[model samples]
Target: MYPGVNMDMEMQNVGSNGSEAAARQMATTTGNGEGHTHRGPQSAETGSLLQAQCNGGSVEMKSDRRVLALRGPQDSTICRMQKELKDVVCWKIPLWMLLLFLLLIMVAIVFITLALCPVFHQDVDEKFDPSTFNISRLFKGNFSLLDLPFSDDLLVPSSNQSRALSRDLQGKLTVVYSSSPALSRYFSKAEVHAFRNGSVVAEYRLTFLMPEQQEEQLRRFTLSREMVYNVLRQSLHQQEDHGTYIDPLSLTLV
Candidate 1:
């Protein structure tokens, strides 16, 4: 401790003591006593970790240099921005691309839906019609009066307008004017009158027998009714005539 006695050794000892003291002070200030201080900055730091001490490693005990560790606003801001930029650069591109791709897919789906909306149709007539099948008949001549094969099979009459009289004819004919399901009653009691050359013979009733469903027969009966009425009108003189409205037999389908 004498002035400059063993000067070099004393200086070396003092330097070591100061380094130990600074290390202890840093450990205390950082609150890193529990093994954390061992991982701190290396000996290359060369300066005191704490502020208020000047010459870096060692100058003289009392040098005039003032130690100040000041980070300006610009430097602090730049460090924070660098960390944030690194995070975004590492993870944002794929996420943004995924969002854009989803949006494009949704737009394409909407456009496709709009383009294909007008291609649907639904109006069909499902009723079975005889005209849909190709068959023709002439019922106004003497050939039709010959005893048809249908004479024996007709079930006499039916209940509920008409019932299971002819299972064979049920699906075969489109019965137009029927108050009953069985044509058996009409076939037995109805009459036939024929017309030729726009002139009809006087009305005569004939039982025309049929084995098959005859929509054509019903149409023929209707035509006969009209022709007979007109021929009768021609026969009577208007001054002496009283009108007779013959009731066309009403037929119904079951």
Candidate 2:
């Protein structure tokens, strides 16, 4: 062989052997215990330069290096963050605290159900009882009977003149007076006066049937007109003496 050709071949073989040895050294130094590879600063720069020269361009090498540099640090940071989050989430809550939280949730649910559900609402409307409400107000001059619930059943006097007394002393009579226009035509002035004074000639007797064990029992009561008048007079006097009206139904007549 020619001396010049022999020198050229020797130089080429030395260059290839040097490149292979450098690659092997880099691979060995950058390997992790788990057999994964990482790039050290020196090895990464040298490898990129060598790759750029072999591939005939610096642009591809620079792009690849930038991508590797960004991907490696970002992925490692993200994985570490995920592991920390998992560790935090694995921590157990105390039994007492968990029960307390559940109890609070149950209470909230009950309150929401009560506020939003219509099933618990009362269906019966409140009724106005005339026995409990004002009754003496009807006797007042400016009072209108139209506002009363029992206005249709009451009778008003036609004339303001008193009636003559009956000759029969033992004969009992019924007298009713009301402010209702429909029944007023049937009443005399004397009857209206008696009603206002809480007195009437009529007497009444009441009876009650009560269930006792498996059988029913009868109880009788005899209420005279004078006794009824006395109770009414006393109730009216009490209403006048005190500013408050008493409920007639609350009185135990039996």
Candidate 3:
């Protein structure tokens, strides 16, 4: 009985030892599997972080390139020139318009002033006067002679002498010789004859007696129709019953 008991106890002890070793080996295998899983996740996270850093660096490089392009010298100069040109155009247009408006205003003022006031005026003292002339010889007789009494100072030849007549009857004149010293020294003669239809004498001959020595000068003298009209008009204006004033400057020849 004692030997059987000893063999059973030894078998029990050996089984117990084998079970404990198996349990320890299984725990070590489970611990190794957990460590491998943790390592796999950490490596994947590191790789992802590296890729993100590369993308960020590429974006920053692109932004730097864009900033460098905008800061170039030629582009900056062009922008400044465009700005200055716009400012000049904005100022110059109004300036030119203002100048033109001022010029137009000056022109208008000049025209208005000229129209309001004249620089020349007519004189009253230089009016024509013919109160002392005889004018009845134009319609009197067939050979009636009318005499004109002119001032001696006006008829005497002197320096700056200017004289005119209203007729050219030198070739048709009948020469009459007179011996009057007053007539020779002072007065000249002019004769006017009026005809009817180029045949008969209409009224008479009017004569102004002058010196015989002045006959050569009288032959060359001629007068315009305006002078004749002036004389007639002045004579008519100075009539005894009907006197009127006439402005000499108002007479126009043409």
Candidate 4:
């Protein structure tokens, strides 16, 4: 071979070796830059280093380096941030919806209770007056005395002796008239009075036993005007002494 050809071949070999060494150095620098470039501020430094290396490098190699350097860390960071934002949104949306749903349910319950609940309004009589009412006006009349047949002097019993005369009269009346077995339970007390015609008459008052249902039964089944007159006539006749006379035509009930 000629001396010039040998020299040209040697220069080509040296240039190819230099290009290989530059590519190796650029690759090493790109790896180190990727480790350091974690944020946006560090990207400018990495880009500046790659641009400086690309000043003498091939166009395709420089473009490939730029693509690799920008794509690796930046895309990974952007994707991670997007995923975190999506997760935050997912958590917040459900929480807000749940709170709104609970509030709506509470509102619905209150509305239903108010709508369905009953309202009572009591009616008052406009003509009624409480202060003008008198209880004593109801008992203005006196009880009528029943005239009964007798054979003995019928003395008037004193009204001030509590219940002694009344109880004795009740026992005599119950024992004399046996047609009614439970008649004694109705006679609460008796009052005696002397008339101008020398006639003594008795007025018997009634009282009901406890539990008002029993009182209703007694009033319905046991009490009558005729029955009272017969019982009083028989009872008085049994305790007579033949000195008194009772008129049967004067018998009346009040």
Residue-level lDDT tens digits of model 3 in 110-137: 9988886654545553332333322221
| Winner of 2 and 3 under lDDT | 3
What tens-digit string does per-residue lDDT give for candidate 1 at 85-125? 45533345544465567899999999988777754433343
Off by over 4 Å in 1: 1-9, 16-22, 25-30, 33-136, 139-254
The parts of candidate 3 lying over 4 Å away from their true place are 1-93, 117-120, 123-198, 204-254
Residue 113 in model 2: lDDT:
99
**Model 4 TM-score relative to the real fold:** 0.26
Model 4 worst lDDT run, 10 consecutive residues = 135-144
Query: Tens-digit lDDT track for model 4 on 1-254?
Result: 59999999999999999999999999999878985665465565555434223422322224324543323455667777666545533446654466567899999999988876744433343233334332211001122223533223334344443244346545554454444444443433333333222343444443323224344544455544445556656555554644323344444444
lDDT of 4 at 163: 41
Question: What would you estimate as the lDDT of candidate 3?
Answer: 0.39
Ranking by TM-score: 4, 3, 2, 1
- RMSD of candidate 1 to the truth, in angstroms, is 22.9
The global C-alpha lDDT for each of the candidates, from Candidate 1 onward, is 0.38, 0.36, 0.39, 0.47
Backbone clashes in model 3: 1
Choose 1 or 2, whichever is better by lDDT: 1
Name the weakest run of 10 consecutive residues (lDDT summed) in model 3.
Answer: 159-168
| Model 4: residues with Cα > 4 Å off, grouped in runs | 1-180, 193-210, 236-245
